[model samples]
Target: MTFDGSWAEGREAPPAPDAPDGPVRATTSGETRRWLRPPWVRLIVLLVAFVLADTVVGGIDQGLDDVPVVGLPVGVVLAALVLFAYVKAIRFVEHREVAELARDGAAADVRRGTLIGIVLFLACIGIIAMFGGYHAGWGSIGAMLTTFGLMCAVAAAEELIFRGVLFRIVEEMAGTWGALVVSALIFGALHLVNPDATVWGALGIAIEGGLMAGAAYAATRTLWLPIGLHLGWNFAEGGIFGVTVSGSHGTVGLLKGTLSGSAVLTGGNFGPEASLVAILICGIPTVVFLRLAARRGRIHPRPRRASAAAAEH
Candidate 1:
């Protein structure tokens, strides 16, 4: 037996070095993973939620006619509730608070862009009228107000769902290009449900409406810009000029008119969405914004294995 601790075989072994200890981040936030779910899963969940909300509201409006004493104002209230539920549900599924993710600067930029876009749209309308739109009776002030309010609400709801939720989710999973193409196709496809929708209409939407909306979202990082653009385009197309919107004409409008010539130019039965002019109107800005966004990094990145591992460790 050796007398000293190091006497074994007249040699000593080196002590093991300490393992690296670092922070470990979670792969998920542990909520519902709404955005991380398979594409079909997310789509189905959204479709079901929308249908359920619609059905419930429709039933209530019909069943309790006298509930509000005057009128239920069901459309307005339902719109608000639907918007709230959509925001809440998306947040819940993502397990991330929008307040935390939202950039104040981005929001401010979106608001500014929205205002500018609205002004540009109004200018466009004036220019179109000057060119030769048949201006008939300017409808009632009340009707105009109602039309504007409804259009704004509808725009907000659609923009929130498409750009805010679906676009964001796809961007998170599939990267920027994937998100743009996928969201655009789906957005265009959705319009096919409208009356008088045609192949041209669908393609035009994919390029003009869908791509423009996505680009605005990517650039602004807030739904406000897209919402305002959507609202203005629809109102200008339908309310101001008496053209169809999504192939449906409103009951009341600010003005009644016919496009001077050629449905190909003015959108004909499919409205502005099917016109080549519309593509030029929407596509230019869309491509510009997309280029800017790609430069700015507003499009979120898909998690790579190396990055994910580093994040986890």
Candidate 2:
């Protein structure tokens, strides 16, 4: 299916005042051609925007962490800024209005995603508990609040970087499957820097984090669902359950839990994100979401320069 460029309304040239005695042609020789940017160029611009936003927000996060009783508020503000920056960047670089990031039904989508994430994590915990790998108890409220703030920052940042930027651009370049594979692998590889990160953990993260989150975006065509899912998972795993998250410390949580068993089942220090149970549980919903996306024709076809050029003439 060819995109006839009609989607970018108002950018097209108006009809000539002195009409020519011929069929109207939208040729590529003038103003219309200027908007044609390659996907790679857009990707580069997106990366630059992401880095700038991250650097600025990271500094703010660090500063806020130093202050007492202000981390949550600071994190909330920074997360909002990061999301705004991402949406603005996408709109500017894509040269079109990004309506997919709209907030009309965002609350519903977020609630749905959050519920799914909580359920999936609960299943992982349940499986581990059955295997004598988890014992749960409570922790301090202050710690839980701090972890919630931090997890919100991490979730918003990652979803913007991975699903919002990388997955979106790569999909335009290489189609949906290509986007899924490339984005997922990169997401997994990025976690290698975490303490106790193993090859298995990375692979697990690829399936659970990358594919699952990308699938969420594909199904909804919005960032809110994926953001909610990511936020929910990390907050539940670390903030609530008091487990390691991607081989990093949980810092503070509501429920304290000890995990002991085979690394395959327990995910070791990398948390449930690396466990086989997580993959199985999360994979089901991921597959379902991808199928829904396919059914809805949400999977974009790769752009063809030849077709585009033909359309121009």
Best by TM-score: 2
* lDDT per residue (tens digit) for residues 1-313 in model 2: 1111331231322222342211111222345535536666666777777867776776676565434378777777778878787767655555554554566667766676776787789888888889899987877676677666766777788888888778877887778888999999999998998889999999999999999999878866777789888988887887778888888764447887778888889998888788999999889878877776776567776557788879999
- Report residue 84 deviation for candidate 2 (angstroms): 1.3
Model 2 weakest 10-residue run by lDDT: 19-28
Q: Assess each prediction's global lDDT (C-alpha) against the native.
A: 0.59, 0.74
What is candidate 1's lDDT per residue for 145-215, written digit by digit as tens?
A: 45555555566566666776667667656766777888889889888887889878988888776788888
Candidate 1 wrong stretches, greater than 4 Å: 1-43, 51-79, 99-135, 300-313
Error of 2 at 34 (Å): 5.0
| Candidate 1 RMSD computed on C-alpha atoms after optimal superposition onto the true structure | 16.8
